[model samples]
Structure formats: C-alpha cells, structure tokens
Target: MHPSQSQSCTAFDGHRLIASGPLREVAAATKQAIDAGAKGPVLVFDDQTSLPVEIDFRGGVDDVLSRLGLASAAADAAPRGPGRPRLGVVAREVTLLPRHWEWLAAQAGGASATLRRLVEDARRGEQDRALRAGEALDRFMQAMAGDLPHYE
Candidate 1:
C-alpha cells in the first residue's frame, strides 16, 4: 500500500486526540509520547476508512512499513503517453442491453471512452465519498466511545 493510500492515522491519548497524519509520523510520535510516559492504549485509527491499524511502536517507521510490505510514500507516478494505459487499469467484460450499448456507442467517444470518462467522473467524487465515510466513522466512534470522558 502506498503511504498516501493508507490515508491519515489519528492517535488518541486516552480519549483525547493527540496526533493526526500519515501512519508513519502518527505512529512514531505516538510511540515517542508513550515512551516518555504518556498514558496510552493509544488507539490509532485510519481516518479515511475509519478502521483501526496497528503500529509496532517499538520500531522505526521505515522498519515497520518494510516489514509489512507497504511503500513508505509515493514511490512512482510515471506519466502515461497516448495509447498507453494508466497504472492499475483492469480490463473486464460488461454486459449491457442493446439499447444501452447503442447509447454508449452514440456517445462522441464511443463506449470505451464514454465509460472511461464516467469512471473518471466517479473518481472525482472520491472526496465526497470520503466525507460520508468520515461521517459514518464519526457515528461509529460516538457509539463506541460514548462512555469515555472525551468521546467526541
């Protein structure tokens, strides 16, 4: 996983949020703070997915990620030339009704190009999706941490 894809990790001190950023920095800082005798059970959460992620606070950031087989940061972003596929493109079959196919074919760029543009438009909605995911996570956290002193 790319470091950016890991999204943000938030470290909490007891019920209070202490640090928020990439997993590496958040983990290292949390470890340092804990080592300095901060009260912990420091919960680290993936901000985007709202899922819990573990960190070996005992190890350095690079050591941890390398051991886990995740890239530490954006490793490469080679530009795609004309007629070249972008990274992670997957070819799959789609079955549409005849009329649907006709509509797609009628599009200025035809089916494949129209589909690609549609996918790109959906990709642009990622931020809105993230916000919704965050909201869902907030509701979850509220329920999970409700009894704690600083739940919100």
Candidate 2:
C-alpha cells in the first residue's frame, strides 16, 4: 500500500509495544490498556509514516469503533481505478561534475534509471531509518513533550 494511504498504527505503552495493526485494533488495545490503568501514557503512531495518532477511547468501544468505521468508509468512497496510480515523474536540472555525468552516461540504463535504482534502494532501507527516527521521537517526547499541555 502507498504510505499516504496507510492507516496501520502501533500502540506503545511506555517503552513496550502493546499492539501493531489497523487503527481499530490499535485503538481497542490502547483503550483496554488505558482502562486497566497501564503505566505512563499510551501513544499510537502511524506504522509507516511515524506520525502520531490521537485516539479518544473515553467514550467507550462503540464510539471508537464507529469513528474507525466512518473513516474507513469515507476512504473507500474515494474514486479509485485498477492498477497503480500514474508515477508523476518530472524533469529537473541536476548539477553534477563532469566525471559524475560521464559515469552515469556510461551505465547500461543511463542516468535516469541509475537514479531510480538508487532511490529504490534507499527506500527499501527506510524501515531501519524509520525505526531509528521513531526511537528518537520517543526520546524527544520524554525530554521535551512533558511540559506541553495535554501531553497524554
């Protein structure tokens, strides 16, 4: 799935991971944890994007489920066609030294294909990068986010 289209979230109770899956599942799990009086705070983050997801389980399971269902149904209502969306590739000036351009020109598939390959390889390694970033964000929250109002 495209990163932008993903709704998968991971719920963390303090340093330990509680649940990782769809929004509804994570929210339910988080609710249970909160109701059971879990330690510290429960935070849910987008699995792929690493963005925070705020879930209000104060209204109980039905309210949370209804919200999740509405969100999914709204997304499903969007107009979509079979096959992947068009890859919006655009040309831009890339300034490179003479030898760099020469090497790219000498490659089997030329500069564009080489650039694409390089990007795909970097993207493939994003899971590790994202994990590091997520950890860093948690640390940041521990140090800096405490003073913020309504932190939990």
Candidate 3:
C-alpha cells in the first residue's frame, strides 16, 4: 500500500532520533545526513508500525523524492477491477465453516458486507490497537535497544 502525507517516519543515528516527519521530509534529512558523512548505522522507521523502513538513497534528494512518489502514482494509476473500486473494496477469499457461512448469508447485507461490518465492529476498540502498537514498539525496542543497560 502507498503511504499518505499522514504517514510519518523517523530517522535515527544509532540510538539518537535525528529526524521525524513525513516520509519525504525524513528521507531528505536522512540523505543529507548520510551525504555529510555522519556516523555509521543510520536507520529510518515508520512511526505507526514501529518497523524499519527500507529506502534506496543512492541518488540525489529529488531522485529520492521521485522514487517515493512513484509508489503513490502507481497505486493511484492501478486499473480498476471488480467489486466497488470507488469504495476501495478488494475481493479476497474467505474460508469459513458451513455454520459461519450460513450466519453470514443470513445477515442483512451480503456476506462481504456483513463480514466487513463485523470486522469493523471488532476493530472499534482502542484497546486492541493500543496493545498492537505496544507490541510493535516492544519488538522495535528489543531489536534496537536490547544491548542498552536495563533496557527492560
């Protein structure tokens, strides 16, 4: 999936946070730092997922931005397929038990709509999201800060 302007990222020089903002901005900052011969082991990460971001910074800043923009362009240029392209609905297989299928069939909307509603309802709780973010952050910390004193 292509990231939007709201998709923020952070760049770190070892354990220190050097840049934090939109992907393009952070990438520019990172490229500049690396070009200026900053210390080794600089990395970038997605703030939402707490996952390391892999960016190819081989070219100039404009080229870097162009590469990042291409993803957005490609996603937007994708040919519309079946199943409500305007609504951004993608069709994927769902293997359910016969009873579950029967229940979905009995719902007011079709199986897809009903399943979407059920999933939305289930995801309505902030607790689930908070827990997931915490877990992701924990994983990132364990990978990046495990060697630090009393990281736990």
Q: Which candidate has the top score in TM-score?
A: 3
**Per-residue lDDT of candidate 1, residues 47-134 (tens digit):** 7666667666656655665654555544434545544245443456475789999999999989999999999999999989979997
| Model 1's TM-score against the true structure | 0.53
Model 3 has an lDDT value of 0.77
Instruction: List TM-score per model, in order.
Output: 0.53, 0.45, 0.61
lDDT of 2 by residue, 1-152 (tens): 12223488788887678898877667777877878888956777776556677666767766766655534333345556544436543346466789999999988899999988989999999898878888857754754366778987
In model 3, the worst 10-residue window by lDDT is 70-79
RMSD of model 3 against the true structure: 7.4
Local distance difference test, candidate 1 = 0.70
Score each candidate by Cα lDDT.
0.70, 0.70, 0.77
Candidate 2 displacement at residue 97 in angstroms: 42
Point out where model 2 deviates above 4 Å: 1-6, 70-152
